[model samples]
Structure formats: structure tokens, C-alpha cells
Target: MVRGKIEIKKIENRTSRQITFSKRRNGLFKKAHELSVLCDAQVAAIVFSQSGRLYEFSSSEMEKTIERYVKFSPDYFVPGRPQVELYLLELKKEMDIMVKKIDLLEVHQRKLMGQGLGSCSLAQLQGLETQIEKSLRIIRSRKAELYADQLLKLKEKERELLDQRRRLREEEIRETLVRPMLPVTLHTGKDETGSACRMSKHSSEVETDLFIGFPATRL
Candidate 1:
């Protein structure tokens, strides 16, 4: 006999809904059991009736299967104390590792600062000395490089200033040479009436002689 498909909707009658729920819930649990047996898998099913009755089935211990699910399921809310304890244990391990690393760093820092030397072995002291010497060499090399760069910059600045001063001096000399000279008048010896007379009508004809020899020789 061909059976027609039933339309899926909420049953209107309470008795009919109860009967349907009971039959479907039993079928679902049976299918879960079959799946677990056939595939050698863990399966669980939980249902609550309209009257608030709880029904559950599990391939193994119900608690163990649910705990496993919680551990593996990303969206599952873990309300169990055992899971919280496991998380605390993991957090403690990470904190212990971080604390150890911090202690090691503090010890190394103290050694570098030349403190707490009494606990260090001879080899450790020697290694620290070598590391310090290397660091000093790096620092001194960097400082020398900086000094050389500063000296080079100062020398360049001095050269620029000297060039600027020379340019200004040359410009001053050019301006002096380009300037016009003022006219100068000269008087000749007095005439027969003992009055001074001009040597020429214009200053251009006036002869101002120049002597370059010693004064005694000229006399």
C-alpha cells in the first residue's frame, strides 16, 4: 500500500499531539540506537514532553558523551565544573612558563648592570665580560662616527662662510672702483703783486706732479 506524505504542522488536538510526540520520539531514539550500533559511533538524544517529562538516551554514559560534546563543540556552553577546572589548569601552566621567562630576564638584566655577581660562576662572569666589551666597542664606534660627521659639517660651514666673505669684499672693491672722483683745484705761486693766481682756467689743465724718490734726494 502506497502511503501519502503527512503535512508537517502542529497538531490541533492535545490527545493527537501527545500521541504523535510519543510515537515520533520513540522512532527517533530507535534510529539513534541503530546509527550507534551500525557505525560504532557515540549518539545521544534528549526530549522533553508537554507535561515536562525528561527522556534521554546515550550510546555510552550520558555524562561522558555530553562532556565530550562540550569539549569538541565550538558553540556549546560549558557549565560543568570539570571543564572549568581543566581550563584553569591550562592557564596555570602558561602563567608558570611566563613567570620563569620573566625571572630569567631579570637575572640577565642584573648581571648586565654588574649586580648579583656573587651567584655567578667563573665562566658566566667571563661570558658577561665579553658581552659587555662587545657592547662598549659598538657604542664607541657609533660615537666616533657621530663626531666625524659633526666635524665634517662644521668644516663645510666654515668654508661656505669664507666664500661668502670673499664675495662681499670683492663686491666692495668693484663699487669703489666704479665711483666718480671729485675735481680738485690747485694754486700757483703768487704774481708780482703778491696775489695768488690760478694755474689754469680749468682744473683739467692743472698739473699735480708726483715724486716717488726719497725726500733728501729730491732736495
Candidate 2:
């Protein structure tokens, strides 16, 4: 039969309570004895029943174990000192250290802003000046680099604009070169009967020669 897990509470029945206490007390003593023998450790356990029955177990003299514990404990420990007081003392020391660090940082900040010169030696002041000068140089160099980058972008944009203008001019020139020219025709006056007459011989000859390329140059 599987036994149910025992709930950790005060046993109500007197008979069951006594049985449980007796069983647990023996178990406790057995565990202490085993722990001492296996681990080579000193162990002590003491318990009292509600009816003033005493139960005790110890691997060595219990008084000697207790004396060793007290001896190894913190020197500042006392019989009535609360544990919270020790924590509070540690916190106060840490707060003092933090306060000192904050004060030091504030002084450094003032020095960086040129406000703590009164306490600085000549060499310290010179070092501070050098540091500031180096920082200024770095800042100025970075600023110049930024400006140069912007100038380069502007120059590139200018070159792009120039190239676009040149391409447009070339396109315009090509259009002009490819344009068709209109033919010119001369008007001759009509005769009295409103009928067209042949041009004068000289004029006809000149027109023929001009239009036909000098009769193909007989020579």
C-alpha cells in the first residue's frame, strides 16, 4: 500500500501527535549521526516536547561546538545586535564612497570648464590647456573634413550641371545641322493676254546655267 504524503502541520490527535514526534526525533538523531560519521563533522541537535520531555543528539560536546561557533563569529557581534544594523553600517560606508566620487567628478567637471584654476599648479594648468588645445584641434579637423565633403559634393553637382548644359548645346547644334532648307522660286510677270510667256533668253540662259551646273562644263 502506498502511503499518502504527510502534510506539514500540527497533528490534532494526541496519540498521532506523540507517534509522529517520536518517529521524527529518532529520524533526526539518526541523520545527525550519519552526517557526523560520513562527513567527519561535529553535529548537535536538541528538541523538547510540549510535555517537557527532552531529546538531544551530538557528535561531540555540544557546549564545545557552540563555543567554537561564537569564537569564529564576527568580532562586532553581540548578544542583542540586530542583523539589520550591520547592513545599515555597510550601506553608510558605501554611501560615503559614492559621495566622495560625486564630489571628485564635480571638481573634474569644473576644471574642464576652466573654473578650478585657483587650486591647480602651473604644470597642471599647462596640462589642462594642452588637453583643451588638442580637443579643439580635433574638433576643427573634423569640421574641416565635413566642409570639404560638402564642397566636393557641390563641385560634383556643378560638373553634372556643366555636362548637362554641354549635352543640351550639342543636341541643339545637331538639330540645326539636320534642319531641311526650303527651295526658292522666282515669279515671272504674265503677258497681256494673261498667258505665261517664256523667260527672256539671257535670263533663261542664266537660270538654266545656274540650275544645271554650267551645262556640265564643256571642257
Among the numbered candidates, top lDDT falls to 1
Candidate 1, residue 207: the lDDT equals 50
Model 1 clash pairs are: none
Tens-digit lDDT track for model 2 on 20-95?
9999999999999999999999998878676544567889986566556655677645677654455546646765
lDDT of every predicted structure (CA atoms) = 0.82, 0.79
**Candidate 2 off by > 4 Å:** 1-83, 183-219
TM-score of each: 0.48, 0.43
- In model 2, the worst 10-residue window by lDDT is 206-215
Q: State residue 121's C-alpha deviation in candidate 1, in Å.
A: 1.3
- How many angstroms is residue 123 displaced in model 1 relative to the true structure, after the best TM-score fit? 0.5
